[model samples]
Target chain A: MKLIIFPPIPSILVSLFVFLALRHFLELRERAPRLNWLLKYLWVLALPLLLVVRITGSRWDTGVFWQIDAVYVVLMVALAGVVLIRLRALQPARTLLVALAPFALYALAKVPDVFLDNLMVFSFGNPADIYWLFSIAWLVGGTLVAYKQQTLLQQQRLEHELEARIKARNQELEQLVEERTASLVRQAGELRETLEELRVTQNQLVQSEKMASLGELTAGIAHEIQNPLNFVTNFADVSTELLGELREEQQRGQEADPELEAELLTDLEQNLTKITHHGHRAASIVRGMLEHSRASTGERLPTDLNQLADEYLRLAYHGLRAKNKSFNATLDTDLAPDLPLVEAVGPDVGRVLLNLFTNAFYAVQQRREQQPGPDYTPTVRVRTRLLPGGSVQISVRDNGTGIPEAVRQKIFQPFFTTKPTGQGTGLGLSLSYDIITKGHNGTLSFVTEEGQGTEFIIELPLSARNSPAPTPGGPAVNPAPQTERSSG
Target chain B: MNILVVDDELDVRALFEQRFRREIRGGQLRFAFAHSGEEALDYLHEHASEVVLILSDINMPGMSGLELLGHIRQEYAAPPPPAPPQVMMLTAYGDDDSRRQALELGASDFLTKPVDFVALKQKLLQLAAHDDAPPL
Candidate 1:
């Protein structure tokens, strides 16, 4: 059998390579759970095995005995058997122990050689060779352990940094969501406030419309009542004359005949009766005017606008005629069929119709005054129809001396009127505009020409739901020439 | 004396004619009628110096009593204007502003409708007395 000799250069290179590989292995073992088991067992058993192998290999002078070779082969076999068992079991700790066994035996065998060489003082072999091998093994093992500790510390630092970054990211996401939710809530609140304001504006418009209609009625009533009052004054004057004449006859120095006295009494009674009748008639006219002029107050209910117009027209016409029996004008009505019921304050709406009718009557009367000839008898027309977009429109047209263009625009302004100073309050159209536009979410307008006549149109929403609730600072019905009057 | 009753109501004029039957018979008073402010103005223009007093409603279509009063005042304020008749205003609304405006327009007095017959007669009597007196 030939023995292999180790060159000094190869031995040093092998030792350095082995030292580096072992250091790297120990570093990997500490960081990974897979290496934890290996670390425990390799440190315990593999160190001793490597030392034994080293000791035996270097002690060749003790004997070239076959037993030593046998022992070396047996130790190698045992080491290889441990590796096979660890591989088969797939245990990290066992594999590390087996892997270290050969190195440990080599190291141990080197130790024994050193001890033997030193014990024989006269021996020719150098003990320094054995010392060098043992020193190299210790250096390699110490470096591997030191590298393992450093790797473990670095891994812990990485884990802590990763955990902190994750926590910070989650906190930022939560803050962003909260900010977005708060903005949405604020926007929703603002929207609700705007809706509430719109409701308030709508209510104010309706109230103003009612007031305008009442004012118009007041003017009409004043015009209508003046006629009958004139008659009362004249009749009273005439009756006083008759009474004076009767008293003069009684004072005369003559035997007053019972029959003659009775006839005189009868005549006086008849004339007085006529005076009383006429006076009462005038009073009734004034009463009707007052009632019509009062503000409308009623509960909201579903009502047909067409029926309301018809009824009020008749009442207004009769009331006007009662005061001025000589005022002769024809009334015409054009009402649409099958209008849906409108939710409204019934009395309030009725008053509006009454005001419109009376104005129409006065307009015709004015026409008659302007042209006394029989060729032109005054005529008033009232019309109602369902307008587009679910609204009802009512118009009162008069064939009278039409409104002048210059003053037409100013007519709806409060305290603006063509009538004499003592005659008009000028609030009629202004109040009417407010009611229809603001109160009912409706519209009122008129068309006029200097000679043709005037037509007033009122548009009202058909249903309560279609009418928007009043809102504060929302668009309100404005009483001006644009809305109140038109020129054709 | 011939008198004209201006009013829009036929019944009112008829009542006046009925009450003054004795005056008509004795030739103490004669009556004519006009139904509107314009008519009354036209009648006054035609009858120049014949009317004793003008009683009018302040509220009337086309022209009101106050406007008529202004016209009357203007006519009388001029030179050689025919005997200025006494003017009175009657109205349903007796608001202070309206009454003040009427009186300022040279109306003799303002009365509300329905006027008291006795009071109106007394006013007419006083006006007639003044008419008989010489102008200041």
Candidate 2:
């Protein structure tokens, strides 16, 4: 017996196991380049050769039995050559080892057989059985190792993709934050500029108020002065015409009646007297205007409160009338008969009184315009009283639109105004308050009912009555009578 | 011709009377005076048909010239007196606003003070001639 130790069935079974292991390794070819090429050649050359040699040797009996051993040695040499040449390019050393394990173990199992057969000494009980057993164990172990390596590679690929996405998201968030911060900084700069512009406008408004006051004074002065000046020129012109007529009569010689000449002379004399009177009246008005225009001397003098009130009241009324010729209001004054003089700056006090009177007139005028019914009459009342506490109280009241509740607190604040832009400087009441409370040691206050009326009161102590050298400021009675009107 | 003069100044009456002395004496023109707008309206109400012309001051104590003009235009618009008297406005303010308002309110003419007697006389004479002409 030639010992038939390499049974055909076992041979086919080991080859099949090797085929399945190598197929699994082929799927990981990209991960293990050198080992993948080695396994591919083993599948194509060694597996088929082993099958052909076993079939031929089994049929021919002893004729080609050495051919199987020859083909095995050749396949092993070819696999070793390929693995050695491409070894450096292979990645992940553990998976490469697992992929090449079956081939390497098979080659080792064949080493003793090749040496023993080449020496031609002893054919010891068929070493082919040990080789076949080694083949089955290595193939099964290699397949399991290859499957484990494939799972690890897939997990690593997933982790790398997730890390890249996280980095890109972080970069996007940082860029958004930067853009928002820049926009906020730009808006802050714009707000700063707007505040600066508002401050400049406020300053300009204050300056405009002074100009407005001067303009009002000039208009009032011009209108008041024009009336007397008109009389002066007209009288002078008439007198001249009268003289020409008288000369023409004399030229008529005997035809001229004596009665006509006397009448002409008498008229001429009367006209001259009238001219002088008007001229004097114009001069007095000019004097008062000059005093008004002069800068206040700030010199305190014993001033009659009643006289001061009356003068400012007229001045304020005329000033308003000069701007709007259609404006009219009744003036009611109740001046105290026994009021004593007080030491105060005349122009300063006059300025305070003018501000109060102008405000009262403006309020009434506004109301009258809104309510044009026949029953609505615009009235401003001024009263002076000697209080028992040795102080003089002056109140100016108006039947007009009163101060609204919202603005009452800020009424005397600087740069606060109820009037429209360009009409008021917002300094009138503030300056008046300063002149009364701070300058004269007096109190100025007001009471108001919205949509109805307002009353401003000013109280001054009478301790200055004993001050010597009282300068008597000229005070005149109200020129226009107040009575029930058919239309007001 | 009958004319009414209105002004707040009391001396305006004397000045106008003396200035038109020749015409007044010859009975060519008769003049009446009122010291304020109220007085002028009262006079106008009493002698409704007598006044051929009216001269009024704009700035006055009781009623303004514009207000008086409005009242006159509304109250005396009837044709009984052939035509409503022509109104001439006199103002110390020669501002265009007042002049425009006066014209809009039916004032026939506007004058700024001090009154120019020479120009005034010419205007009065022309008006008198226009009035004296026979109706077409």
Best by TM-score: 2
> Candidate 2 on B21-47: residue-level lDDT in tens?
877888778999988778889999899
- Lowest lDDT sum, 10 consecutive residues, model 1 chain A, at A1-10
Which residue runs does candidate 2 get wrong by more than 4 Å?
A1-212, A246-290, A301-315, A321-344, A372-377, A381-395, A437-447, A457-463, A466-488, B78-82, B129-136
The top-ranked prediction according to DockQ is: 2
Error of 2 at A322 (Å): 4.6
Candidate 1 CAPRI level = incorrect
Candidate 1 global lDDT: 0.61
Cα TM-score of candidate 1? 0.44
**In order, what are the TM-scores of chain A for the candidates?**
0.40, 0.46
Q: How high is each candidate's interface RMSD, in Å?
A: 8.7, 2.0
lDDT of 1 at A50: 44
Candidate 2 chain A vs. true chain A: TM-score? 0.46
Model 2 accuracy (lDDT, Cα): 0.72
Which parts of model 1 are misplaced by more than 4 Å? A1-346, A350-457, A460-488, B4-15, B18-21, B33-36, B92-105, B109-112, B122-136
